[model samples]
Target: MKRIPQCDNTLGPLDFSKMHTVLVDVDVFNCGAGPIPQDGRDVWHNDFVKMPFSLSSYMKTGYTKQTNTVRWEVIYKQLRSLSKKTTASVKDLEDAIIKYNPKYKGQWSFDALSSLVKADPNGSNYSPKLFQKIAELALRLPELVKKAVPLLKRGHPAAITLSQTQIACLLANAFFCTYPHRNFSGPKAEYHNYPSINFTSLFGNASSRKKQKLRAIMHYFQEVTAKKLTGLVTFERRCLKETDLPNWRSSNKKMHKLHVASYGTIENEGKGMLQVDFASSWIGGGVLGSGLVQEEILFIINPELIVSRLFTEKLGDKECLIVTGSQQFSNYSGFGDTFEWKDPHEERLNRDEWARLQRQIVAIDALPFKHRSEQYNMNDVTRELNKAYCGFKGHQSNEPDIATGNWGCGAFNGDKQLKAVIQLMAAAQAKRGLAFFTFEDESLKQGLQQTYHLLVTERTTVDKLYSLLQNYCATQQAYGSAHVDLFELIRINFSPSKSLL
Candidate 1:
């Protein structure tokens, strides 16, 4: 079998200077940096959290006829009973989850959980032990996260940074479906725009893919519960207001460095660089459901990121989410339907000043096109450019260069060549270098490298490329069904005219 390629060291070096990031404190880079204040106008929305640390927290116990009680105190009795059990069945686990989430009783299914347990129902690794550990972790949510978690609401440029332990505890709660008011989703739902949080959807869908997803998630609980976890992870929602967006029609920026390769992947080869996630408008697109594409795969491996769905609002077109210091727990082979969960990934990365792993990821969703020609419309092209720019633009001068490739080309029905050029232009405008990963597509690797060479040789500026795109869009519309290669057109436009002696 062919070995995995090495591209992490090739992407670029890490700059240790104090680059301005989305950290709450400008100077201090720790979770303990400052006091997390309550809702101060447009800053934070702590009004929604029902956890013990929030003002909205209340106790309800048998006040009416000594029967109605909403206290979590009553909820812990069932969780503790399940945790102490040495031979709990999948049925017992489901019963316990439903006891706490009574509203979802008879509504949520547990087929996936039952199927996973049956695979090794009596084994040392599966069943009783694994199921029990998950309950214990879920029970510790209130104790672990003593501070209220603010919803990373819409139209707000804000962040919520939590320690790895806090993230693990939160995910454990999601696994047991303990979050309140999060199960409902629709037009009138409180968080109608956000992705589903509870793991009910994941637990109900029984398939080989679901089994693999459970393996990764279960492994995370085993590791975190058995050992001491460290480091901080942050989720920042960045919005590019209309005025902050670049005037793509007239910009004089030039492309920086380019390293195109057909081998290696974004997470592997692109390590330590600003990795780009080809995400959906709803972050972690269908991770807890039937979908298993790029975005879903990303969230599964790094379960820490799955916690974002609990608070992050649905992303806007001009917005992106930057995750700093998330650790990859498992590695896998295959893409889409062929995906399989490989073994554990030893955390070899060094920690930063704030105890976060030396890792950064930016999530940017591209337009999903039904018909390929729809992307060539100038309005659509402009939107794509701005979306890429929103993710690529540097928060500070010392940021690492970007590592990406074929961003919206897979299930989104995007043209690979056009997507590549859009990213190039966005990277150039952002003034950062780029390392393009072709995911073993040699042809794309060659095409991208040649295009980069031509663009650099002629010293093509961003505005020049923008003008070329305008003409290409017009050509594509006029030609109708005929396909035009974007790179070939660039060569024709950049090639020096025959010298007339």
Candidate 2:
């Protein structure tokens, strides 16, 4: 066997401070040419205002009749003021709960459940345990909501509160995990690491204080405060930083979006401002499901006006203009014309573009592993590999290759490039402090690592493109001499090396 080339690792430290700040801003575009709504309120149609609140409240209740009654009556009245709107059916609610928890669907009646809800005006008769169970079961409502009005409605406080609170919980978990670990000393022994709740520890124990322990843990998280067992070390004060853009500073602004444009207007009492959007829908609040990917810890900053025209643009009530953010802001305000605005939805990448971008994403994924490797010069390999991957889509076919001439996109050598992309992803996850290798659920990471090694054995840096030719030649040479299939030589060679020696 030939010696494998050793990997190199070396790189300058990356500055992350610039990526730490983020801002969130939002504006609603008007569908009609009218004065913008004040106080950031978007007007929903009648269907939105009249969603079935009473039924939703009923769904929140468990077997208890009394508790469901009061809640039902309150929501029914609220629902009456607006035109009828469809809400999630009782069956849908049940399914949502089952999906959320993967348990508790078998314990209840769906038809009788509705009957109990209709019969009772209040859920007061239910015990705290029942109420708690209902709360747990109803946790999935937020995920099912299609519109924002019902989420913001006053009557459905439980769903609204749960939705908001769940979002908060998710954000809080992310924040907590971002911080460095701590040191602790206890009766059992000294320990070091982030303070984490051991769900198994609580679940496995059969002690009498189990309920009390659970409550205590919940209270700690709710309060965002640490409690000490021996009155010595605090557990909660150290949480994730509340910074807006911790990762953006290290990333390219060209790649990271500050805002996406969509159409709408901002109007006050008499005057209206119009904006043409090039980006799609945007929320001023921080984006969820970011930071889960490589080379970025995503968060929403205040939105920017990608394109806008003032109120007096003489645009027809139905027409809109889309502009780029680089355009001057003063161009938007005018006097008598009603104009509609829409962000550039057309700019969103098509399927082929997305696939190409996926290659870049994979490249970004490899960066963290590169930085963490024991090899120093290998760091350049990581960055250059990522840069090449990200740049591949924008490159003309005639451009020189970064790794090899055959390494261009969609070439036969693409399999090797794709393998590199996978390797980079594993490296990035490792850099994010995740346990990539040991985690069974991270199949992407595992598969990438396996494929890289396979390619390594099948080919080499020295052989590069001609490794296949070399292997085929060696096999054909044996066949030409013996006039037997290639397998016979391999079988004879494998039959006891010690006896042959």
| TM-score of every model versus the real structure | 0.88, 0.20
Put down candidate 1 lDDT per residue, 213-262, tens digits, no spaces: 88788778778888877677878888889898888878888888888989
Number of backbone collisions per candidate, in order? 0, 63
Tell me the lDDT of model 1 at 414.
90
User: Number of clashes in model 2?
Assistant: 63
Q: Kindly list the per-residue Cα lDDT of model 2 for residues 1-501, writing each as its tens digit.
A: 000011111212211122111011112112222112122222233212212222332333457665544332432232222112233333443443333223344643344333333333243221223322323222322232223322111111111111222222222222111111111224342111112211222222233233222222233232222221110000000111224112311421111101111222211110111110111112111012111110111111101110010001112111112211111111112211221111111212111110110001111112222222111232333333333333222112222111111121111112222333322332232221111121122443344344344333332222221232234335544455333322232223323452357
Model 1: ten consecutive residues of lowest lDDT: 1-10
Error of 2 at 114 (Å): 20
| lDDT of prediction 2 | 0.22
Off by over 4 Å in 2: 1-421, 425-436, 439-501
Report lDDT (Cα) of residue 457, candidate 2: 39
